[model samples]
Target: MHVENSLTHYCIPCDETVCCACVSSRHAQHQTADLVEYIKQKKIDISKHKIQIAAEHLPQLTKELEVLKQAKEVYQISADKVTSKAQERAELMKQVIDLVLDSQLSEIQKVKDRDLDTFIFRENEICFQIEDMKKIVADENGGENAESESDFNIISAEREMKQKLESFSISERSRPLPPKFIQGIDDMIPEISRLLGKVERVGEIDGGVTQRKSAAEVKVQIMNTVSCAKPGHKVTSICQTSSNDVIVAYNTQKSIDFIDRNGRKLKAKKLQFETQDITMNKKGDLFLTVNDSSLIYKMKTPGNPTQLYNGGPYKALGLCAQKNGNLAAALWKQEEGIIAIINSGGKLTETISYDRTGNKLFKKPYRICENSNGDLIVTDSALKTVTGVDPRRHRRFQYNGGTEAKNFIPIGVACDSSARIIVSNWKGNSVHLLTSDGEFFRFILSSRENVTYPHALSIDSLHRLWIAQKEKVVIVKYLK
Candidate 1:
């Protein structure tokens, strides 16, 4: 309605620029200021902000962009490498198939060569018999006037010739039937497809950090501390998002909570039942394992969680994210336990029950984590030991705490960029470091240093460790 009129004044009450017509209309009672002055002030503010951006934000963003580009380059190189490997496997399979094909063709040639040998022999024999018969009729000698009337000898010769013919005859089944090639390519497609192997998209590396301090040179110090649990809520699990926000799961209260970096509270998602373990996927969806139900649930950010899987009678006791963007869920039933490997689509791809020598791998898997080297780190709370399994499904080592830590209760497990495993010793009230090969390195933190009963552990991109102990979640930076 005011498109035809030019704005000249700013209405203070309405907080909008007004034309001459607006002055006598709804904006007549409101205080007004010169639009030209307001425009000047806005320009001044924009210029000031532009200077701040150039001095502060632009340089930081440029560096961040460079880091992001490097990450992209790394990802592409890794993908190309895997693709070449898969192609090599396919080429090898093709060569093997060609060998099989040549084998069948060679067999057919063998049959042909064998049948031709018998046929040639029979042909020569029949020719000789025909020559003998010709002699019976005449020409026993070179001249045409030999003995030409011998009936008894002719009858006896004919009987003997029939017996010779019978020796060269072949049985019907013994005769070759030309081998036909039927469809054999797609018979084991499901199995043959697996031979090429899957292209696993490993989990992302936040901020592209790939370095860590050695055990001997590490300095442990508290970086930041946050508390998400209420007075009586028990913190069962704690994990970090890509943005470094904390997500805590409560088993006693049957709820999941979130908190941002600035200590501001985010929207908390409730749960229908208590969960023992919780994990976040690459897609930012949170997964939790209910203690009583066999169902595993996935929760979208700022939304409710729904059922993502059912593990039959073996309820999931622990959940963790795999480096291949898959999920590692530990389930227990009937005093036996197994770790189920699930893909991103919520389908169970494989299950690990026994090691290479057919020995039981675990009886109770409490908490699980996947290392950067594709090894699985699982804590068996029942046995009070940690099992390290390699990618080949071989149990590499079982780490029962050292002599000093007799009653070790390993609760949460995590790994740094160098594959150094950090375990929270709940009973010993310390955090222990283990080499990538599962050998004991040293204790990084202990209750003597004010770290009491470390329950869950998480290492972030900045090399900060978030340890959940009691009602407080403490962030520790052990890497120098």
Candidate 2:
């Protein structure tokens, strides 16, 4: 019974050693190898697997378990610390709230007690008056000699009763009941809870994850200086027409001069009264504010100026045309001024004297302009700030040029086609660019050689900024 005859062949599919007779019978279709060779290959594979489990798999799994245990400990410690801190803060807040609640309750109770005592005292005084009247009536009802005594006593009692009644009437009519206590905790508790939740969320967030936005950058440089008005005539205000023509208002000359882009005089009109400010309407007609007068004049080319609107009590100073065919005028009533919005039909539409919060919007409005969004931009000379008013006649925002505009004294304001507000600060000797909402965007021009006292500002159809200074007008091409 040799081993080769007994179980020599190893059937790979059945994983069993078989004899030659078994291979011929049940294992005929199976792949078979010699038993000794199969055992030797399996031994080598098992040895390699054992080395991998001992050297790599087991050691790696043990290291991972140790790391997980350490992480669990760290997490537990952190959670405990956070919980302790939150509890401490909550306890402190509760103590503070309790103290405030107790103090408020004590004050309210004192008020209630005082009021109740006053009411009780008043009731006792009323009862005492009733008893005195009853005694006077009883004495008057007695017989014979009581008649004469009662007559004298009745007159005196009647006089005293009338005085008491008058005092009681006053008290009954004038005395007010105590105010009822209102619990505001119902409204405040939700807000406080929301704030606490926000605090917790903020604590969880990393401070390094926040990103900041960069400020808008703008560069402005002067293009050239051009004499747009007559020599020795002061330019009070400036505006641009649709055809790129600039209209300059001369207060001393009482005239408006239309000049081309190159400072060549194209057309000139002599106004009856001295003009303070000039603006152009949609039809290219000029609206001029008569200085020290409550009248605004509308002038067309080759036609005499006609009275556009009567400002009545307000004296028109600076004027601008709105997109809706209305006129916004900076009018001075007395010491304080207002921005008046008048319709094209010479009717006063609205007046902005005070803000929605009932605060004075302007002390002395010098220049006025309407933005593309129907907002009125005005430079308040007395306040030294540029103020914006919305179409609904509410004060939007005010800009005093912050620290960047040193010694700011805004005198003129204009809005460009891009909705950017241009303000000229005469005292500061600088021109500032602001957003439509009256935020200071940048400094467009600063006084230097040849540029002093920038008084008026206007942006033309070509986006060129025309600055009216004393004696000379500086034109700058500002790229937003």
Candidate 3:
């Protein structure tokens, strides 16, 4: 019985409440010498009772620790949420205060403006009434002496009122222009002041904000035809002058005529050239390009054309004012080919030579114009294509519609007011409309009848498409 008791289970390290047979056989040669020495040295080791106690209370300790950890996490999360909410509240309050202050400031400004308007109106009225009194005094100076004195007094009062009104011009009541009154300057002052006070009172808030407002719908009216035109002559180009008169470049049976918009031909004493293309600069001057001539003629006013360059035979196709205030000309010759550049002191400024595929710039450059992006658009009739070149002369619009002339013989080209390219096809006997990016969009032709040949095209401010039929010798206007 004693030997069997010694073989029962016991923790050997504690060295307590184990029979000699258990301690001597199992724990005698253990690998942990410190545990074995502790077991041997302790007077009261808990080896026998440790397992029993841990088995009884481990589940409760585990549950209590889990509860403590969960509580700690919940508390931290709640604190963070409260901080965020407080910040949001603070921001909202700040915005509200600012809006209120701004609205109040706007109202105050409106009130001040109204007061100023009223004061000006009253002052003007008083001045006019005093003027009437002065007129009465002037008319009745030979009456009774007392009445004369009274009229003089009235005149003095009127003069004083007139002086005061003159000090404040009636133009003050006119519209206050632009950003100065965009937010009702007076109304914003109070709102901004309020925001200055309530900045931190509001809690955590996102600084990003959104505002939406409706804008006024502006109505614009346009006229399709020239409002008032000359009765008999064919007007090639019309330029409106700063003096409210249109300088018209017109053509009669014999010579090109210059006239005002009212049809009265201006006395152009110096301009004695028959020109095909005419233009006007902003300074109300004339620029005419004669057929088969290299020089561009400049008429500083309504007078005879003066040759810009006498070294002729270099046929300048088109002339336009560049952004740099220098004149740009497209000059073409068989040897020189086609080149466009700014003319500074009769010298070329920039030159571009090749297409994207390293081909020559133009076979026979006919006309050139500037597009919306300030690019020079040139029409090469021999190549049967239109090309857009940058200021640096790099080819941008290499519009190659095959080598076939029937599909792409662009003769007359003009840009409409909406930036749509209108090109008259010499071979096709039709017109092609191209988008600003040089993409072919649509065809403009009278489907009812095939016109013989469309020569030149132009677009007026009203977006009307005008085609000059050389064979017909008549200019026809078409709907857009």
C-alpha lDDT of candidate 1 relative to the true structure: 0.78
RMSD of 3: 41.5
Which prediction has more favorable lDDT, 2 or 3?
2
What's the best-to-worst order under lDDT? 1, 2, 3
Quote each prediction's TM-score.
0.54, 0.53, 0.44
Which candidate model has the greater TM-score, 1 or 3? Answer: 1
Stretches off by above 4 angstroms in model 1 are: 1-218, 262-264
Per-residue lDDT of candidate 2, residues 1-480 (tens digit): 437559988886465789988888888866677788878987996787567546745765687679778877977898898888778878888898899999988998888888898878878887887787687568656543642556778798689868866765434544547767677887787866764443343221111122221122335667778775557777888888868888888777767777888777788777787888888888888888888888999888658889988776878899888866888888887678987777887766566788767899998899988886667888888888888887667888989877644688888887876577888778877777676667656666675434578888888777888888865688887764
Model 1 per-residue lDDT tens digits across residues 171-196: 77754566566766766777787776
lDDT of 2 at 55: 70
Each prediction's whole-model lDDT (CA)? 0.78, 0.76, 0.55
Q: For candidate 3, what is the lDDT?
A: 0.55
* Model 2: CA > 4 A from native: 1-219, 229-232, 404-406
lDDT, model 1, position 430: 81
